[model samples]
Every structure is written in structure tokens, then in C-alpha cells.
Target: MLNIQNTKLFWASCLALLVTSLSFGIRAGIMNQLGIDFQLSTSQLGTITAAAFWGFPLAIVVGGFVVDMIGMKRLLVMAFIFHLAGIVLTIFAQGYWSLFLSTLLIGIANGTVEAACNPLVAALYPENKTTRLNHFHLWFPGGIVIGTLLVTLFVQLGLGWKVQVAMMIIPTLIYGYLFSKLDFPVTERVSSGYSSSDMYKAVLSPLFIFMFICMFGTAITELFTGQWIGLLLKNVTDNAILLLTLTTGIMVIGRGFAEPVVHRLAPQGVLLLSAIFAAAGLYMLSTFTGNSIFFAAIIFGIGVCYFWPTMIGFVAENVPKSGALGLNLMGGAGMFAVSIYTMFMGNFYDNLIVKHLPAGASLSVYLKAPENSASAQALANAKNLAGPEILQATLIIPIILIVAFGGLVIYLRSRKKSRSVAL
Candidate 1:
């Protein structure tokens, strides 16, 4: 233990994680709400659902540069302003464009928070960087647990999703105020005398590239499953909301336990095993159609629990020279993965399977028309074709990527040991 007394720093980092996680939580909770409220077609739904992810890459880049140029304090403030503004915009969003734009703004804030806090936590506890990082990430899924339950309650109480979204502002405001009083450490690019060239070199290394591949798979696995779980569950189970809550709740619990688990297994071993389970889980989720489908989700969640944070934590442990640049690069690369996966998968899913209604059918007809209309027939056909089986099978992309990343990591480690022996 590094005699850690900076409770403020730790909690502030957790709050940042919580804020980012809740964005996904609220978005998942309200995704269906948006479709119903806006009478969106499946294509429109896919685009809007992926809009938040589209902002992530830019947010990561801009936030990192801003933190380097200005400071984490200023970046945090900017992120909070953007987050608050986006949340408000989303609550009152009238149509597709507004929802897309608002989510992009929120994505910026989410990415900024990650860019700032990840490096901050690593600096606060240099010796226990990975452990602290994993612990900090616990709040993310933890926040999702809270958000899921809260939104479920609100819906049951007849408050609607808008009110549920507005509740996030309370935490945003509180965290913003608390962050104001804390001392933000200078980013590595500033304190360590790393020039732009050095940072670029750090980013271009084989190690960095391998980690980036892991980041891509982790981001795809985390977001696609959580975001689309509701859709997947609905295809197999009657109570989609309850099943979603259970799956998310289990995910949170698994993340909570990951710190201790990673400590024992080591990051590499854990990641290797995680890939195996993740592949099997995705295969199960895809091939199985019964209530047993959720069992696969559980396994998938457990396997991926340590994947994302451990990717960042690996850099913190191994790449000290990269400094804040390392942490920012991790966040940037990870969210960039999110942006690409969301855009690619969502669009492909929509155009390939979701678009087009039956003859004489439109968005309005799907929303308010009788059950026997052509719109209903078209929607049913679309839903049936694009069912849980197909959606879960799509997860094979991440599972395959995970195996490749594992092989890459293995090759890198072997090469490093061989070089050391020659030296």
C-alpha cells in the first residue's frame, strides 16, 4: 500500500468512471424509448443508436490534446458542461437528428472523462496502477447497475425515460463541484519532458499496436452486447426489461470481483482465459434459442469483465515512459474502436436485415397501426430474420478478434524474452 490518503482523488476518478458508465446505461435504457417516441424506422434506430459511439474517437483525441495543453481540471469542467448540455438536449429531443447530435455530445464528454481520469488514477497510485484502475472501473458497471434499476423503477412508476435521464444531471453537478476542489496532476507530456515525437513513437510501437487490437475487441464486446441485450433477450424471453436488468446486474457484479481475480491470475493469464470463455459464450448465445440463452450472456460478461480495464492497466504497468500519453492513447484507441464497431455493425445490421416495411407501410403505420397491417407483417419479418440467433452470432467478430489478440500478445512476449536472452 502506498499510504494512499488522497480519498478525494480516488473518489473523483470513480465518479468520472460512474459518469461514463451511466451514459451507456441511460442510453441502453432509453434506446427503445427513442424508437417509440420518434416513431423511428429500424434504419433510423440503428443510426441513432450508433451516434454516441461516433463521437468517441474525436472526443478521445480532443480531450487528450486539451488535457495536455490545458490541464485535467479544465478538461473535466469542459466535459461536464458538454455532458449536462447533451443530457438536457436528449430529454427534449424531437426527432432523429436531435437524438444523434445529443448522443454525440455526450460521447465527447464520456471520452474526455476517460482520457483525464485513467492517467490521473495511474499517477495517484503508481505501484498499484492496474489494481486501482480495475477498482476504478468497477464504478462503471456499478453505475450501470444503479442506472438500470433506477430506470426500471421510474418506468414502473410511470415517470418515463426522460425523467430517468434528467436524474443523471444530479450526479454530474455533484461530481463537477467535487472535481473543482481536487488537485489535478500535470499530464505526462508536460511533466516528463516527452516531446511530440516521443509520444508518436510510443503510439507506434508494436506493443501499442497489440494493445490497440485488444482495445478494439474489448470495446466491441462490451458495447454491442450491453446495448443490444434488450433486443436479443426480447427475441427469446417475454420479459425483456427484467432480463436486461439481470444481465447488466450480473455484468456489474463480475466487474466488481475482477480486481481480486486479476490479482491472482495476472493480466495476461486472465486475458487469455477470457478470450476462450468469450468465444464459447458468444457461440452459445448465437446457437441456442431457449431461455438458456442468458446463461451464455452470463459467461460472456464474466469473461469480458477484466478485458477492457486490463488492457488499459497493462499499459500503466508496462509503459511508464508513455505517461499520460499512454493512458490517453489507451482511451482514444478504445473509444475509437467503439466508434468504428458501432458505426460498422449498426449500419450493416440495419441495411442488411432491418430496413423496409411491407407494402403500403411506413413508420407511422408501424407505431399506431393495427396488428394486422402490412407494417406489422414487415416488422415481424424483419425482427424474425434479425433475431437473437443472428445478433449473438455477430458477436463472433469480437470473439475471433480476441483470439487473434491473444496470439499477438503471446508472440510479442516471446519476442521480448528472446531479445533479452540475446542481450
Candidate 2:
């Protein structure tokens, strides 16, 4: 029988995760507006956006270390405060720095949600860690779908970006209220009698370290692409935000029905296959244009649907001794990698525009031109030419994941065989 209290806590965690993903979707939708309104370069925009990723790692790592001592409720309270503050600050942001700091705060809240809730769900359903984790994480994409649709609708209605951003406070408050009223269980690591030293030692194990490194590739493959979908694919489609909606919509379905897939393929097998599809999908996106990008988006969505949760679940199940710290560490590393990559991608994208432009032509000059002028058209042509190249460059990350995950599959199988033979 299900414990009602545990189920409620689980759903509350889902709601909290929804707020995190809403921030992502809303931010992706508003990237261009922020750039234009601030008269900022792509690199500056990227830096502001990347602040969230940077702050994510810091909060999750610290929350992980202290969660056991400080308790999940307190951490969630901190998340609530940060979320409310960040959203309000973002709504009233005047310049790049304000936006950066506000986004950083939201990122911290996002990380804290994962820190408390990953272990919360794991502890709630100790018997079904991977499937439940996948179910819980389904809300990430699920919330993105909600957020993106809101942005689409708001855009249609001529609503400002700030209004879309303000909408996040609704779910944020709901989740905050739910968490405050409920009681949290002890983490699985604590209940299972593992010491802090055991967790520390386990996280440093060879296998854990290997997976930790692999998280970087998987995360960038999924997140960097999703977050920048609007900008990267803008020239390809009239409404690029819809592509984010489409991809995340597919993810919601994939993750919602993750159990049978998880059972059939195992996490390692699923990851290996995901890497293959993600690489192929990215390649197709670079090569294809117009409506064909939809097909490619479908492929890309399926490829990344299971990545974040499965990665966390694998650690939780296989490296149980590593506990919350290990889980948060994996998540933190992924976000940190994304932060660095976002900055690089912004500069690389700017350079690519220069490469495609006429000799000695300045992009800034084009930017300052009238909307209907020849310079504006030149800028458009340059962006169209440069956009696909960004996707092509990202293709390498998933290609690397294919090999890494393939090796992991073989290694795990061999170990399973060795243990069975010995037994």
C-alpha cells in the first residue's frame, strides 16, 4: 500500500521541480527580447544566461553537503525565498547585471530543489528509485511544456516577457505552501545506516568518478541545446520557441512512461541508445532546414528525454553509499559544464557570424541600422548562415557520449557476468 504522506511529498517535489523548469522555458523564450532591449551582444546575453548555470552548481554542492544535517525542509525554505526574490528581481531588472544576479538566484533555487528532492524521492520509494526518479523528473520537461505554451500564448496576446516571468510565482507559491505543511522522511542514506565517511568514500570511487565526468557530456547535450533552441533555430523556423515546446512535449511523454523502457534496456543501455539518437538528431538538425527540423527535433527530444533522471538514478541505485552528495555532485557538475559551454558558445556564435559576413563588415554596424535597411538584411543572412554551424559544433559532445556510454555498457555487463559466475 502507498503511504499517503509519502505520495504527497513526492508530488510536492514534482511541483517544486516544475518551477525550476518553468524558469528555463521562460528564459529561453525571452532571450532575444533581453538582448534587444539591453542592446547587448550575444556574448553578453550568454553571460547573463550562464549565471543560472554557474549558480546551480554552487547551491547544489553546498546543499548536498549540509542536507543531512540541516534537513530537507529547511533547504526547501531557502529555495522558496530565493525563488520569490529572483523572480521579483528579474521582473524589475534594469540592466545586464541585475538580470545576471536575479538569474543566478533562480539557479540557486533550482539546484536546491534537486538537492532536497532527488534524495527525498529516493527515500520515499526506496524500492523503485530509477522509475520514480524518472517520474519525478518528468515534471522538468512537463513544466517546460507548460511554460513554453504560456509564452506562446502570451506572445500571441501581445503580453510582455515580464508577465510571463511573473506567472512562475503561482506554482512557486503552491509548492512552497505544500512543502511547509508536510513532514519529510529521513534520506535513504541515513535510514540505510551509511555514515558520512561512507558517502564521501563512495563518491570518490572509480565508477562514481567516471560517471561524474560523463555527466558533463550528457548535460550539455541535453540542456545547452534545449536552452538555446530559440536562438539557434530561429532562422530555420518562423516560431522557434515552438521547437522547444515540441521537444519538451515529447520528453514529457517519454519520461512519463519510462518504467517499461527502463526495465527492458537498463539505465546504461538506455543512455547508450540516447547518445546515439542525440548525435544523429543533432547532425540532422544541422543539415536540415524548414519543416524537416521538426523531424530532427523529435529525434533529439527522444534522445535526451531520459538523460538527467537516469543519470541520477544510476548513481542512486549503483552507488547508494555516495548518498545525496553524489547525486547533487553529478547534477552540479553537469550545470557547471553547461555554464562554461554557454559562454564559449556565445563567443563562437559571434565569431561564426563574422566568418560568414562580407569582408571587414562589422556586426555592430548592421545592428544599428534601420529595421528595413540593407545592413539588417545582411545581419539576417549572417545569422542564418551561422546558426546551423553552432548545432554542428555541439554534435561532438553527444558523439563522445556514444563512445563513453558504450564502454560503460560493456563494463557493467562484464562485471555482472563475473559476479554471477563467482556466486
- How many backbone clashes does every candidate have? 0, 0
Q: How do the residues 180-226 of candidate 2 rate in per-residue lDDT, one tens digit apiece?
A: 99988888889999999999999999999999999999999999999
Which 10 consecutive positions of candidate 2 have the poorest summed lDDT?
A: 363-372
- RMSD for all candidates, in order, please: 2.9, 1.0
Model 1: runs farther than 4 Å from truth?
Answer: 1-5, 188-195, 351-368, 371-378, 389-393, 412-423
List the candidate 2 regions with Cα displacement exceeding 4 Å. Answer: none
TM-score of each model, paired residue for residue: 0.89, 0.99
Write one digit per residue (lDDT tens) for candidate 1, span 1-423. 333436687897788778777878777777777777777765576677676776666777776666677777887888889899999998898898998888888888887788788777776777777777778887877787777778788888999888888988988998899898877777645666878778778777877777776777777777677777666455456655554566566666766677677778767767777777777776766666667876877777676677777888887776666667677777777666666666666656554443544544444556655667776666656665565544565667666766776786688679779999999
Q: Rate the local accuracy (lDDT) of all candidates.
A: 0.72, 0.93
Which pairs in model 1 have colliding backbones?
none
Score candidate 2 by TM-score against the native: 0.99
For model 2, the local distance difference test gives 0.93
